[model samples]
Target chain A: MKQNIYDNPTFFNEYKKLRESGITYNDFIEQPAVKSAISCLEGKTVLDLGCGTGEFVRYCLENKASYVLGVDISKKMIEQAKIKTENGKADFICAPIEDINITDQKFDVIISSLAIHYIEDYDGLINKVRNLLNYDGVFIFSTEHPIVTARKEMDNWIKDGEGNKLYWALDDYHEEGKREQHWYIEGVIKYHRTISTLVNTLITNGFKIEEIQEPQSTSEGLNKMPKLVNEKRRPSFIVIKAQKSCVT
Target chain B: MKQNIYDNPTFFNEYKKLRESGITYNDFIEQPAVKSAISCLEGKTVLDLGCGTGEFVRYCLENKASYVLGVDISKKMIEQAKIKTENGKADFICAPIEDINITDQKFDVIISSLAIHYIEDYDGLINKVRNLLNYDGVFIFSTEHPIVTARKEMDNWIKDGEGNKLYWALDDYHEEGKREQHWYIEGVIKYHRTISTLVNTLITNGFKIEEIQEPQSTSEGLNKMPKLVNEKRRPSFIVIKAQKSCVT
Candidate 1:
């Protein structure tokens, strides 16, 4: 069966098995890069949206976060998260982020990894994030880059019968929204928006951007996984660190 | 005093002189492609926005349009238009499109060429076009393509002293909105939005898109102006035909 997200009970189990065999994309590339972006986790209340398999939660806990909440739209993913939890230090909830109350609690840092691209309405979610944060609180997130998302024929040209490389085709770079992507799995619908729309939405919601990053292979990553070097040609993801600034 | 739009008495006079001397960009491209997008203007009321020198109005008049309105931000352009206009067959108005009340007169065809990029808000203007159109009324417009508009450098690469080719650097393709472009005129601010944003906005505002075109040189146009061939590399303008469908 094709693995669907959020509530796929066997999803993490199969994925973990793949990672153990060194065939996983995230274990080598995105996870480590996203982990390093979290600065000063100690004594902070953190909310991790789309916390699939609770990787970031463990990172925050290892870094001594005071309290952590891992919210995932997938019930099965949250089930896996719960198995790793103890005491009241870390928590996992199975609910769509759009339905979360967020009123009874406040967070010092809010983070989502590879999640926001699924969201259809950006402005509404961003505005909601602004309202959920404390004054000067931080929000850090990562999603698929527009270039990666905008591509229709994400296929590189294959060699002909004589082993001659054909053209590497990338079309409709400017067309955005709701592209079906085939990666480790097939038929994954992802929403695309320009970097300006993403950044401008943050700015409109009173956030001061700290960093806009396109993660690439470190020399160490390249040493371990040589194929990672191809990221320099075209970025696959974008990570942004922004702060809620007090604005008039 | 620096020449301002709408009432820039010197803007068109200087620009016309440049075109006369073969020093203008659009004189060689875009204008003809845009004019041809108007399939039929016979017996239709045509409203042309930012109708500098009323060229489209004259075209529509020659094609036997019922009536035509040429509204330009530049008074000097309208003044020149007036010299060519005669007794209510054509009329010219000097006003910003945003401030103009389009409700009073419904149109069968609305065309804006090389103008919407200067306007900051696209959704509002497109919605206004919808409201001002009769059922099945068509709105055809052309603006600077987002790729050209997003360019910060706006500079072509040149050979160095040793005749080495310089970089054809195209960075910031994903960033949208305001970019300062320099061509014949210096420091001209043009707003850029991705093709998705532009098309999606039109769809969102209840206009059924008929065609989306990147206006390039025809073989005939290339013969008339050899420099027009360059449009094949990177399109300078996008022409869209959207209709306000009679839907409940």
Candidate 2:
């Protein structure tokens, strides 16, 4: 069965609160970086995997995509997305990304933002994405940086007496498997994969990596959230843009 | 002028002793990993960049490579390579890898072992290698892992009160530039680059990433050097095997 931590009431409430907050890491660091990877969306068909609340789905519609489909496992999230988005160009599907039955549909671009780490079978997902993309289509995604995901405790840091983060405490990096950690509640599951595994999986599945970014906070972001300055020390995310090459 | 720390008597002597010890990281960890990336060499022409003392050069020749050219910036290293290698199939060139004028010759395989970080212009070097490779040629190389080179200190480990390493101190990881550290002597220079930069450079240069390995210590390695167990916590090297696709 698919893990649906997003459906948990307490966790969903806390996550919704965090997303609404203007100063969250996703707001200050991830969104800008992910948006930058996206090219002109005019007339393009888009698929947003793990599309929570349809933020990117709306962005795609705003950017003039011909059509956009948002997929998420949480019924609550899909309901929220449907309530917020009223455009005919936008559609929502409440299904686990791992089991999405959208193979009949093809997309000009497929994007997933900060959601890939939640999926257990990364190779299968990549293969599915490859099949769902039209020839020369693009697959762009942002995931928690391997450095952040290498340990069981997400964002593991060594702190000083005064609680200032000294450095990231990295361990069990080579051990690739399920990592259980607590967010607002206990037992939020994510998989730890090394950078090599991430890149090699895409290459083996017929994606030609085009651009990669480990984005730092913008000046505006730093002005808004001073703690974001620490991003210079360690990246919180890794974004990759790859094109589907000739079928292998 | 290129950095030739390898020719410094103190550094050279120290390095020679470490390689001869057969219990060092290279002997127990890196060599085995690097050699595993290499395939059958029968009738293939090979080039070894930054080939120190002709180890890989001899390996290729012994495996039936038609010709092997070993290039190093250090005259002393090339001299040692010459003195140790008597095979007519092998030749040594004492020139900076950055300055080698080898556009006239192309090789079936180009291998560099743990020497890429010393070069400044990575993009230029990769372009040069691409041009010097036969179509469908393979370029396999290993370098200091980005995590190790991210800081000015080669291995910045935060240790406990009793000197037990707690975790790696990772900072300035996104900052890509020249890094100066101490080896056998002061002012040893190396370049720092993120994993994104490394992978993107290869992709942009028309090489399809075939395999990327962050190798763990073998059981044999663990028996020889117990310190190598730390490699599981964090990788010390990254080995990549990239194949040159159609010229682009």
Candidate 3:
């Protein structure tokens, strides 16, 4: 079976609490950047992979997307999403994003928010996403940056005696594979891939890269959360926008 | 004026010594990876940007390139390149790569080896390169990886009491601009650019990225130089191959 750490009760609870707090990297940095990358959603069909709690799905619907389908592995998260989203245009699937079988539908835009690192077969998923996209369609995603995922320990920062962060600890960057680490609980699995692999995999799978954003906290964001100043030292996430060629 | 540290007698002599040693990162890690990215050179017109000593220019000619032009800012380096290249098809220009004026000619393949980091205006250079390529022409170049260039100090590793490297010290990654640091001589200047900026600059300038390689040391390379094993911890260079689309 695929790793479903989000379905774990402890992880689910902690993740929900973090998101609800609204003082997260997601709220201040990643969410704004990802939202900015999406163009006009009017009349466009969207597929949201690993859509936790259907936040982006609801946002897409609010932005006038004709239809938005969200896929999540966590049944608890899907239940929460169904409860939160009352719009008829939004739909949720409680299945692993990798195993989602939507043969009858192709989307104008496919987006995933901070959920791709859980995927073990990156190329396979990319190929599947390619087939699921219409001509000239777009795919945008955000994932844990390779620098953050590089170290096996997942202890991102090295601190001095006074607990001041000295620098980000980067190692095993080229050793791409499963990295098991702790988040809210133990044995949370994530795959580590270098930036080159990420870019080349998209190109090899026939995606034309449009933009790449390593989101940095803005002045307003820093003012709201002073600790976010550390974002300048190392990016925690990488957001990419790629398009399928019309001829392809 | 553009930074011409390569013309400094002390710096040039030291750099020459390093390249001649055949044990440097350029030899073991970078050169091999950059060369591997270039395909058939037969009958191709080539441009070597920041072509210190014209090493890649000569390699292209040896691989049956019909013509090669090398541009460098350092007079001393260009003089050495002229002396080293005796082929009639090879030409040298002593000018900053950023200021090269070869509007009359278009190249089939343009390659640069470990020189782009010194350039302050990345977008202008990419735009110029796009205009300099023939339809469907390939542009391949290598530069100091953003991770290596991120820190202002350029003191890559953080070591323990016994002088063992604990981890790479990464900071100032989001800050993209000129960075002055010490090499053989003090105050060598290089520009730090995030991977996002590097990739987006090309895409914005109408280039389709073909491949991006963050070269790691192979078993043979490590066998030749044991210290090269550290390359796995972090990439020192990023080599990218991009093509000018035919329709564009």
For residues B164-234, write the lDDT of model 3, one tens digit per residue: 98888888889889898988999989999999999988987889888999998767779888988888899
TM-score of chain A, cand. 3: 0.97
Q: Which stretches of candidate 1 lie over 4 Å from their true place?
A: A1-14, A19-24, A156-168, B1-248
True-vs-predicted CA distance for residue A114, candidate 2, Å: 0.7
After aligning candidate 3 to the native by TM-score, how far in Å is the CA of B161 from where it should be? 2.3
Give candidate 1's error at residue A209 in angstroms. Answer: 1.3
- Candidate 2 lands at a TM-score of 0.95
lDDT of 1 at A8: 38
Q: Using TM-score, rank the candidates from best to worst.
A: 3, 2, 1
Over A30-74, each residue of candidate 1 has an lDDT whose tens digit, in order, gives 666677767788999999988877877988988899999998887
Question: i-RMS, every candidate?
Answer: 11.6, 1.4, 0.8
Predictions in order: chain A TM-score:
0.87, 0.97, 0.97
Q: Write the per-residue lDDT of candidate 2 for residues B128-211, one digit (tens) a residue.
A: 999999999999999999888886555677788999987777777888889998898999999999988898899889988888
Model 3: residues >4 Å from true position, as ranges?
Answer: A246-248, B246-248
Model 2 chain A is weakest, by summed lDDT over 10 consecutive residues, at A149-158
